[model samples]
Target: EMGHVLGIGTLWDTFGLLKDFPGPNPTFVGPGAMKEFGTLIGAGQPTPVPVANVGGAGSAGGHWRERVFGNELMSPTIGGPGNPLSRLTVASLGDLGYQVDLDAAEPYALPDPFVIAMAGGGETAPPRGVMLPTVPSSVPADRP
Candidate 1:
């Protein structure tokens, strides 16, 4: 939701935000994203590191690399104990056309040491923060 308001993820698979770069690939994430975020850490650099391509409906090939950021807030996974609000994330926000306060970015460490494992079958919790109550079968909203 916040990302929508801030213009992060796109409603379609088109990487219009990253149209400036040249490549046959249609989607980009991580280092490509970092580069777009005004960082010198992407392709053509001495050590070009790219982010993970989650490849889901809305988050795939869009969010920051999971293995690189691990428990960092922007990664697909939201582990317990919370994640860091990294400068890279803020920079991405800026790339997304948001006015970011770079000074307010949180300190982040690479290869986060505390990556919380997800549940079995590689299933993760729903992304939504609020849970809606389920209505009983055959029950109508107008009924008491």
Candidate 2:
């Protein structure tokens, strides 16, 4: 699972206090995803609703569920032959206070699972690409 700060704002603050940096603190798009696609509001929103992560922190459970995200890169498991680099992730980077090349981000369709069975037998998700972006020098160095 991908391990990151609970939210982009947290990451920003940590870097700011530690490295004496300046920039907008990360923020969510809104309470939820926007109704329309490819849009950003004037003011930033709250962070996305994270997975409960009830048992403990930072394990295989640290990421979005595969059953829910299908082949999205942040999903805990990568069992599929192909992986999808979701726009959500890119937007999340924007939330993390980085300049994103949205055009370079791979598009993804959120999954629509009518029924999620306990077993692995369920609807199949669409394929997505592996989109990676470079963090500019203005941003904090990647740290564990």
C-alpha lDDT of all candidate models, in order = 0.51, 0.43
Q: How do the residues 29-94 of candidate 1 rate in per-residue lDDT, one tens digit apiece?
A: 434344533443344442322333444655454455565556656666665876777776676676
lDDT of 2 by residue, 21-113 (tens): 221121223222221123322225433323212222331223444455656666555666666656565555554556666566676765556
Tell me the lDDT of candidate 2: 0.43
List the pairs of residues colliding in candidate 2: 83-128, 84-128, 84-129
TM-score for all predictions? 0.53, 0.45
Model 1 residue runs over 4 Å out of place are: 11-15, 19-51, 112-144
Candidate 2, residue 77: lDDT? 53
The alpha-carbon RMSD values of the candidates against the true structure, listed in the order shown, are 11.7, 19.2
Clashing pairs in 1: 30-51, 31-51, 52-65, 55-60, 56-60
lDDT of 2 at 106: 71
